[model samples]
Each structure stands twice: as C-alpha cells, then as structure tokens.
Target: MNSSNHSIWFYAVATVLSVALGFFVASHYSTSEPVYHHAQLLPQPRALPEMALVDQQGKSIGNNLWRNRWSLVFFGFTSCPDICPLELQKLASLLRLADASAKLQVVFISVDPERDTSARLREYVNFFHPDIVALSGSNTELANTANFFGAAYDRSVIIESKLFSVPAGIDMPVNAGNAYQVNHSARVFIVNPQGAYAGSFMPPFDAPQLWGDIKQLIKQ
Candidate 1:
C-alpha cells in the first residue's frame, strides 16, 4: 500500500480499537474506585463572568450561582441525541458515588436557547435527576458564560430550503432550522466548592475516577 493509504489504514484501525475499548470499559465499569485518566486542573480557579441566566425555577441567576457549591458544568442542548444525556447520567452517577457530606451539583447549560426556553430546559433536565439544575438564557449570555470555560458551539443550518420544527429533547435532527445541528463542547467543567473554575474532566468519562477526584477537589 502507498504511504497515503497506509496512513488511512492506521487511522481506521485506531478508530476501531478505540470504539471497541470504549465498549469494553463501559460494559465492565462497575461502581468502584479508579485512577483518573485525563483530568486537567487550572493553575488558579477563575471567577465566572456575570451572565443573566435563568434557572430551572425560572429565577434569574447571576455569577453568584457558582459560589455556594462544587458544580459539574456541561454545555449541551436538551435535544442532543446521545452524548448529552449520557454525560449528565455519568455526572449523576458521580454524585451517587461521591461523598454526600460535601455539597456537589450538576449544571446543564443549553446551547440551543432558541428552542430551550426556561420551561423547556427545566422539563428536559428534570428527566435525568431533580438535583441537576438546568440553565438557559439569551444567546449572548450563553456565549459569555461558555467563553469563561473555553467552551464554544455553533449551529449548522441546513442549506436546503426544506423546513421543519421539532420539540426540545427530541433526537430527530430535522428541526425548525430546516434540519440543523448544534454542536457544543463535551468537556464537563469542574468548579471548586467555593465556585471557582478548577479544571475539567474530558471524555470518555469514568464515573468512579471522576467522582473520586471531585470529592478530593471539593475538599481543597
């Protein structure tokens, strides 16, 4: 095979191995202690920027919301097909395994504000777990807040003239934007108990290691 074909074959093999390993880890990963794989901690925790985001209760929240408890913040729209709900469930499992003595919470920020109104967001997040607080706001507000965590997303509108609208939380891609897709960050940004931007946990997330590290971080 030529060099170009060799490179493609190498990547294809790597991709297949990765998918197989992910399945193996997922199937056998039981609730137990584990060593963290790729946890990145910042040199210093950064204060969140002020953004007028509304909580699940439809109350306005400022940056102060990050102050009281350690938060596992993930930026994803409710309509996300697979990763979003799986990530939140992993965070929820972390809470279940984590030391309950310390205060910890999950924050789900919607990137699709046009469809994820406060009411829509609340309903979507509540399906996972009640303690998981969902937040949504104006596009600018979301952008500002997301920037603070180095998170970014973009909506790819279908170029075709066909039009359709789907409710939030539906997995179907053919939506009101004429079959568009909103891609957002998958990293779960971690905040300290004092609500400072501590670090992040990248996927493929291992609940045991993540919660264990979070429990330790909350103590710091």
Candidate 2:
C-alpha cells in the first residue's frame, strides 16, 4: 500500500477500536445497573408546593426537609387497617437489607391528621423503622399538603341512624360508627438529593425490587 493509503487504513482501524471500546464500557455499565420493579422514572421532574409540616420531634419539615438527601415519602394514616402496616413492614425489611452507607431516608406523611398526632405518629413509625420520620400537621396544614400532591380525603360521620357530612370537606364514602376511612392513591415518591421529585414507585413493591431500585439511586 502507498504511504497515504497506509495512513488512512491505520486511522480507520484506530477509530473502529475506539468505538468498540466505548460500546463495551457502555454495555457493562448498563448490565450492572440495578433492576427496578414496578417503578418508572419520571419523564420530567415536577416541583412540590411549599407546605409546612412537623416531624416526629416537632421539627419543621417540608420542602426544606427534602434538601440534602434522597427521600422516599408515603402518605397514610396510623389507623390504616392493612395496607399501611404491610407497606411499612416491607420497607423496614428493605432498609435492613440495604447497605448501611447508602442511608436512605423514609418519610411517612399522615393523611388522617385528626387521629395522627405527632406523638402517635412517632410511636407508630418507630415500631416499623427507627430511622423513619413521621410527619403530621393540623387539619388545615395537612389539607394544604395533600392538595399539593393531589391527595384527596373525606370524612363520613354517622348521625341519627344515617350518615351525614360534617363541616370538614373530604372525598370519602359514608360508613358506620362515624368511623370513616380515607382512600388515597398509593405512590412511593422518590425525591432526589436536591429536593426534586426524581420519580415514583407504584405498588406491589417486593423487597428485592425496592432494594435494587434504591441501590441504583444511591449510586447515582
């Protein structure tokens, strides 16, 4: 081959090798990525409204608490019959399995503020995960917070052998004993370290699946 031809061939070979190397690296990273089950990454992150809330220790927590670390937030009441307990237990197990260095934070925001006081929430949350933070506020505060996340709630009271609506504005059905329940969507919100809504995990969160997804976030 002529010198010019040889130079061109050598350059082509180098370029091909470089491209191959890049592909290999990319593939390796992709395969090593942790697999998440039942959770989808948001197309674009959404912003949260400014709402005031108090933590287990009565510490103010809201958008400000979201700063500095990733958080997994859930909204439920202490009186929740089955779903709340099950979810909390599963999360506790996952936390135990996750690496200590990862230090994932979990927040339980109570939708039933009428029954979920700061003290009650603290005690309830501590039973499942000591590291978990329980947050609750007055009815007005909670309503504002819930509205920000589009969470709907309603109160059903039994009066004079029939169910009647109280002054409180909630979105639930009427039931017996004035013991009404709040039905809300189950979404495990994943917030980025910068307090941005990273994504959300829907439901049927197996421990392994959650661990994998959370591990991926920790690495990121």
Candidate 3:
C-alpha cells in the first residue's frame, strides 16, 4: 500500500482499538459492581447537614462525627415499642455478618431529646449493639437533622391521648407521659466517609442483603 494509505489504515486501527478498550473497561466495571437486592443506592449523593449533637457521654459531636467512617443512622425514640427495636436488631445482625474491614458504624439519633437524655440514648442504643453510637440534641437541632434525612416524627404525645389537632401558633404538648412515643422512619441511612448522604436500606430489612450492599458500598 502507498505511504498515505498506510498512515490512514494505521489511524483507523488505533481508533477501533481505543473504542474497544473503552467498552471493555466499562463492561468490567459494571459487572464488578456489587448488585444490591434490598438497598436503594442514591443516584446522586447529598451533603449531610451540619449538626450539633451530644453523645452518650454528653460529649459534643459536631458535623465531624459524620466524617472518617461510614455511618448507618436510624432516627427513633426509646419509647417506640416495636419498630425501633426491631430495626436495631436487624442492623445488629447485619453488622455481625458484614466484613470486618468495612469500616461501618451505627448511630441512633433520638427524636425525643426532651425525654431521651444523653444517658437515656446511651442505654437504649447500647442494648442493641455495643458498637452502636447514640446521639441526642435539642428539639430544633433534632428536627433539622431528621428533615435532612427525610425522617418524620411528630411531637411526643401521651400514649392514651386521643388524636387531637393543635391550633395554629400552638406548640406540641411537651409533658407527654413516660409512655409517649415519637413516630419516626425506621429506614437506615448510609453516610459515606466524606460525610455525605450515600444511600439507605428501606423497611422489611434483610440482613444478608444489607450485608452484601454494605460490602459493595465500602468498595465504593
């Protein structure tokens, strides 16, 4: 072939090789990614809210707490008789099965700080797993964190009190009895090492599926 034709042929071959390498890399990357059965991975990660919370020891934990490691956070109150405990148990199970090097942690953020004191949060969360960290904050701080996580909770009300509406400009009755409950989302939030909202494992939780997802997330 002429020199000009040889040069054109070489260029065409190089382009074909580049396109093939691109496809190969993409396909392998996709296949290597762990498939999640029950977890919902966020399409776009979100920045975690700036926070001011007290740990079980009454130590202040700022936004820096969300940094350095993966956090599995659940929002609920000690008074929640069922869902909170059940969800904690599931998380505990996943922790047991998860890879030891995954660098994951669990957090219980109380929505009822009026009742869930730092000591109270510590006791409640530690019952589920010794590694689980409990957090408490003022009502405004708690509400802001919960709103960021898409967790909703109503004001504490007496267990036996009838459903009543508060008039505009009125505040929720804070003296709700010991049996008072703060309804909240049972979903577990995943925060990445960079302190951003990563993804979550929704209700009807499966420990094995969560374990698999956790392994994949750590790889990410």
157-218, model 2: which lDDT tens digit per residue? 66667866543234334333437666655777887777777787888877788988877777
lDDT of 1 by residue, 1-220 (tens): 9999999999999999999999888766633333446678887888765678898788998777777778889999888899898998888787777666767888999878777878888888778787898998877777778888989777765445754443333334544453467777899998776667888988986788787677656544
Order candidates by lDDT, high to low.
Answer: 3, 1, 2
Clashing pairs in 3: none
lDDT of each: 0.78, 0.76, 0.80
For model 3, residues 1-220, the per-residue Cα lDDT tens digits are 9999999999999999999999998999777866787778788989987798899899999888878888899988887889988999988887788777777788888777767888787888788888888998877787788888787777544435575433212235655555554666778888989999988888886788788777777776
TM-score of 1: 0.74
Best-fitting candidate, scored by lDDT: 3
Query: What are the TM-scores, per candidate, against the unseen true structure?
Result: 0.74, 0.76, 0.79
Which ranges in model 1 have alpha carbons more than 4 Å from their true place? Answer: 1-36, 159-178
Candidate 1: deviation at residue 155, Å?
0.3
Q: Give residue 202's error in model 1 in angstroms.
A: 0.5
Ordered from best to worst TM-score, the candidate numbers read 3, 2, 1
Clashing pairs in 1: none
